[model samples]
Target: MTESSKSAEAVWAAEPSTLLRVGPHFRLSDVDPAATPGFDGDEADGKRELRRTNSELADLQERLWAESRFGGERSVLLLLQAMDTAGKGGILRHVVGGVDPQGISIHAFKAPTEAEKAHDFLWRVRRELPAAGMIGVFDRSHYEDVLIHRVRGFSPPDVIERRYGMINDFESQVEQAGTSIIKVMLHISHDEQKRRLSQRLERPEKNWKYNPGDVDERMFWPDYMDAYQAAFERTSTDVASWHVVPADHKWYARVAVQRLLLQTLREIDPHWPAANYDVEFEKKRLAAS
Candidate 1:
């Protein structure tokens, strides 16, 4: 095998969660969106590794679903938070698409509706939690209450400050209910985001993704960074930790996230449940018939 392939194999053999997980003193500013961290692979190698692991990912997902059907209470929730053009859609279409669709539920949160705004921010979120034995994905999660609300001043400063603790409590509750949360922030550079936005404008096929409000949000990039940094400090808890993946390189980001999922599933270690009924009795009855 080529050296790059050897390196990629080593990455798979190693613990990716240790490399990517957010620590108590983690700083979003310290992350470089272009760096690959634990993987020494190039784009081609990364993509190949991602494909190579799909079967394992699929198998683990099927096992989780099977275990759930047999009264297993465990489930997994992958919360993806990123800026516009940070490739959240690509992660869903590529990484997540590799798994069985029946075993997954994906929810993309947008601006709250009139009815939704009438209740607490997490009220809508609770309704979308995945059932036992399934995997749940959130495109942009309750972090928006602190992120955009903090940047845009939708909520008062004190209210937004309170949400950090509230979110920690909420996540702890979810963990107690048997959902393992894997929170990831797709970190991208300012120039990379601008380049992606410009590409969308330049390509007729990508025009639909171009939003005028995206430019409006770009002005608050610094504020958003501060908000995310604060979130890392307050909410990256033992129940559910945050992972920052360098997303300037889409291939690396995809591979890193795939590794994260693999790590979590392996830890959960759901097995193909033992047959509850007698196989010999069923076979004998069928033969008699």
Candidate 2:
């Protein structure tokens, strides 16, 4: 086994979800974005392991799709939230994108449209949910309403306060309806973010990714951290726990997310649906033809 696979097995076979889970009294400040918790591999190993695991992830995904075709209601929703240059786009492309696209649904939430804003915060979110048997990915999700809204003072204090409970309740409802949610926060350090932003500006191919607004948001880093801590405290629950992955090293982040996803799908353990037709009869019919 590769070191990356060993890293995954160590986490999976031992405590499973405990390593990355957000526990009560969890402090966001203590986490080092450059640290790869529970992983024993370097960058090269991580990339190799990701490639090795892609086939398995795809297999499990197909099984889930088959189960849904046979009337199963289980599905997965991967919710990714992060600061700019934190690699949400890379996760979508490298990790989740390894699976079959036919069985996956991806939606990236931006600022709400007038129509979306007319209703409750979750109205647009609810409409974008994946159906039974599909894997859903939200690049930036409902949490944005709380994160940006809280930091920018777009909403009143009381309004922001209430969203925590609303989000928890909404997630619980989604969980109860057979959708397993993997809520991830890709924790990137302030310096690393700056370096990445600078890289985008320096590289001709990546110049399009440079957003002036991101630099403005950096000024409110401390406030965003506070808002995230508040969100984790209020919303991370037994039904739908949050996993914070250190994302300074892009390879490690991708492997870690892929491992978490593999763990979830393994726990779900969906199998291929049994064939409905009689095998002997079909064989005899084919011979006659």
Clashes of each: 0, 0
Which residue pairs of candidate 1 clash?
A: none
Candidate 2 residues lying further than 4 Å off, grouped into runs, are 1-16, 284-289
In candidate 1, what residue range of length 10 has the lowest lDDT sum?
7-16
lDDT of 2: 0.91
Candidate 1 lDDT: 0.92
Global lDDT scores for all candidate models: 0.92, 0.91
Candidate 2 root-mean-square deviation in Å? 2.5
Query: Residue-wise lDDT of candidate 1 within 102-165, one digit each (tens)?
Result: 9999999999999999999999999999899999999999999999999999999999999999
User: What TM-score does each of the candidates earn?
Assistant: 0.95, 0.94
Relative to the unseen true structure, what is the Cα RMSD of model 1? Answer: 2.5
